[model samples]
Target chain A: MLPTQLSALLADPAPGVPEALDLVSSFDQGLVDGLARVSPSAFGGLVDAFAGSPLRDRVAEAADKIAAGSISDEHLFVLAGARSALFGAVHDALLGQADAALGRTRASWPGGSGDAATAANLLAGSRSWLRELAITGWRGVDHDLVTAAGQTIEAALAEPRLRRLATLLDGLAAELRACSPIATMDRLPVRRWGDLWSRAMLLAQDGGRLTPSEPVTGRLLVLGADVHEHATAVQIQVHGILETPGTAPRLVRTSVAAPKVDTIVGPAVWRLFAAHPVLLGALAERLTLDVTDLPLLDSGDLLWSDARAKAGPPADPFATARVLLAGAAAPAVPPLERHPARISEPVFVEGYTAVDGAFTLGDRTIAVDTTRLPSCGPLTPQLVAASHACIGLLRWDDGGWSLQPIAVLTMVKRQPVGVHTTDWALGPTDPKVVKAAAAAGDAVAVLRERAGRLLRK
Target chain B: MDVERRSVAPIIPPVKPRKLAKVPFVELADGRLQGVVSSGSDVERVYVSSIGAGSHGLSCSTNNNRPCGGLRGSYPCKHLQALLDEAVLQYGADRVARYLRIDVEEGRSLTAGLRAHHEPSPAATVFSSFLRHLAYLELPDTTAPVPELHWFPSVGAAH
Candidate 1:
């Protein structure tokens, strides 16, 4: 149970993270029991204490609405919203502290010294944890848990071994005055794969600009293609990186829409393309073209038009592509601007092991988000194990960073081989595609046959 | 390029299935082990059950507030047991045990440590969550863009 002193602190007009933490930590089983039995209206002042918070108003309105009635769905949602807002405020404050500490440590140690690097890595880890807490709205957290987290950060800030890193410990005393919460009520609505794809399509529609018709030529390396099965259409989006010498590589994509058909089964990538000869040829030309001035959208979408094409020197583009990808730096995006299925930045990640459905890069393990992938045909453990690197989008979704691999690179008999992970959806003629399809078994043929018989009737 | 030339070693082994649907929704939130459980007899019926973690104050009632007959007993009802089992499945056994503040040595079961008595908690909140979960299935498979997703970083020049 909260001591009288701590309980008194809860009445403060604006409580800082420290005060909030203390109040939450003081909640024992008996205190929590008491809280559950009481009406939400009894704690209306607590809600009002977060002055100017939109959630506070909403919660107040909800409490009043339910004052003379039984609890309803709105009450539950409002309660969750209130909890999220309160917890989010605290997490955001902690993140600000961590960010400030990082800035100080970096400033003091300009040189890439060992201590500086270790401190930076530790701070980065701490930031990641705090960011995740903010994303999850600190759900299921209790007082003891919050205290342990606070103490750990406190100790890290005061550690004598890293004196330079510890300089920001005094800043921790600064009161977090703002209680504004990023409204999370919208997140309560469960979203599915279709919803995400629709969102991507919507974003793709607006604010796109066409490049000058004067034509800029570059070597286009077709990385891969993803086939999306929607209700009305089978949409195939092909991805590639355009390299103009002395310019930064630009990620580009093109889409092909085909009528929905039920006869094609078992890995639509191979079956669909195999049946569509003309579409297959166009895809082949895109892959074979050495240089082309394709009309392009600023969003990296390629537009079909009177584009020039030429065959240049026969050399592997994968090596140069890897070198370009290594130097690519993604622009920093704030947390609020991130979401699931949003491809904020496209880059290549090399030197990682795929294990346990995640990629281990150095000391950090990022889960492989298959949902964002256009298609999962070539992402089998066998292919992943053989690959040395992958090119994909860096996305912040489900409360953390995930990579959606579009292409995979491997060494076969000492030759660097790059295959579009989505190309398995292309023509089954490709030996790699044939091999993958074979491994998937005769189920494909059986399904195709069944589908064919059904169509014939 | 043919990847078959090289010997393919399996990287990710098949995952062990931890099906958590014995009880549809269980969460450690609001200082309680609470969720809505499907009725054993009626497919359409559900009971909202919650046990305050350390207080062991139990509540089992239908969405409309009718108390369960099982609440008369000192021990948790079958629905609560199912909730605990699913909670262990959702969050690991250790986390569930720790949240409930129950003492259990290594390899001992969590339910063995639980104790409960009747103390009715409002069932509306958990029932609402279950309804929301069901609502996801009713949503149409749509190709049209969703307005709610606009907050995501724009992939175009607008950003």
Candidate 2:
């Protein structure tokens, strides 16, 4: 229902200047509040209705002065209606500019045919659309849309015909600011942004060991591995994830360097993997070699050649050398006992019994000669298995007495587990040594190819 | 809205090298020779041209180092000469020559849009050179002023 004074004015349709100003004065908050609700066509009609009216011109002038801070303590009720009417003028000017440019180009120019419709239609949307976009920004940032609109308007401003669009955009920016309590239209609360990553969990460490929890899922995007190094260790800090799309993406990490993994995989290898995670992932997918055999440094010449053929040049030549040297077979040399030195004094050496021999000590059955003294008895396979130790005179050492311990020498016996490269048993389980080297080689090859492509272009 | 694409045509002629001083000359990628030469006013005119797509205008103004048409060649136009020298060195003589040929073949347009920016100075020269380089990079700007200058793999070395 219209106000009684406004209904009276509408019935007459063409009020005198004094009467028109009095009728507009009746609306204070209502005029400013309803500005966003008016339809573009209806706003256009109002602009046309007040065309060349001195009262309308005075109102627009007074609004401008208020904005410029030249007028203060003025009657805002009249000014608010003027501001609402001012939006109508802005709408008309923008439409005219777009129409003029479209007519000139016939909808084809720098961006070509399809873009003509997009550019014009975006500007032609209702004034309410801009307000709606501002409101959206208030709740949560739609940065891509905001940036596109801003850029489109900026580009339009360069064209002489579309110059007025800038003024309209400035006004819309103000309206958007008004829609929000926050001073900046783009600033938004964290929880308001839907689909943006808002939660994080870190791996915990206990007793010098890294304890891993389950990886976070759902709305997952990218996981960035940041590699940093100290003197003795290299750390791989995973830098969370990017959860939302924007012109300028903002990555939110709730924790700083959390759930870190430390490895002595060498700086070169870590650097290679960390520098180009995407390239490494791509290469890993394409690789036909066993992941267990990765970082193929310890492999012989045959494996090296095969890796080079598959992955291109090694990324870090030094790391490759270290792997190769560490993996090479031992040099061919006889034991020290076989060497011709003077008949040495009695030497004591520790060893496991290999075969049946005389002289059983404890539960050990040592295989060595003890027939020279009565302390030993004849050795048999059963007795030797039962015996734990024995003494013998070694012929290999010029009759020096030797003692052998039959400590459990079974192949099934357990050995200490460690990350040490020299630990033979580790070869089957831990794969860091191999993966690091292979990744380094692949990274070098990929980076070189990328650089080459860019240079040629 | 009634607008049409501006038509473009070549308006300026090749530079007159003789009007220039007997200074050392460096030939640019676009078939134009840049050198310090004396004009009829006895001032040394820095002879620079936007040669490819034809000459954008070849009247030698004094280089940035000196007042316009000053007498001394001692203050050579470093901006024009240095940038050209660097370009020639970085992108070999053959590549630059190839670029020149491409520009020459693509005759200049006379359209208002094709008209060189009003501030026709060393700054403009650098900007035009940059645009040509972007074309070399295969940037997708069909509306770029000098599309003919765009690099093509088959177009000699610069391509």
For chain B alone, what TM-score does every candidate structure achieve against the true structure? 0.68, 0.25
Summarize candidate 2's per-residue lDDT along B30-80 as a digit string, tens digits. Answer: 233233222333332333323222332332344342233421232223333
For residues A1-457, write the lDDT of model 2, one tens digit per residue: 0122112212321223333323332322122223333232322333334567765665555444433434322323234334334322332332223223212111111211111212443344322233344223333323233333444444433332332233234223322222232333332221111101100000000001111111221111111222222111122222111222231211111111101111112223323224333323322222111111211111000111122222222222122212221222211111110111111111112233345443333233323422111110112234334332221112211112232221111221354111111111111122653453454343323323322322332
lDDT of 1 by residue, B1-159 (tens): 111111111111111122222355565666788986766876556678888888878898877788887768668888888888777655557667767878886777776677767899888777654443333222222211121222211111100
C-alpha RMSD values across all candidates: 20.3, 35.1
> lDDT values of the candidates?
0.44, 0.25
lDDT of 2 at A185: 32
Poorest 10 consecutive residues of model 2 chain A by lDDT?
A198-207
Cα lDDT of model 1 by residue, A1-457, tens digit = 0122112222232337545433222221112222224454554554565557767677676556544444444453454344434434554443333223222111111122111224444444344333222223322223433333343344443433322122121111110000001122112112221122122222222211122222457776565555443211244565555677686765555554432222123344344334344334444433434446665543345553323554444333355355554443222212221223334344456777778667776555666645433332434445555677776654443224455565678888998776554444444445764675565454334333322322232
Estimate the TM-score of every prediction: 0.38, 0.16
Residue A315 Cα positional deviation in candidate 2, in Å, after optimal superposition: 23
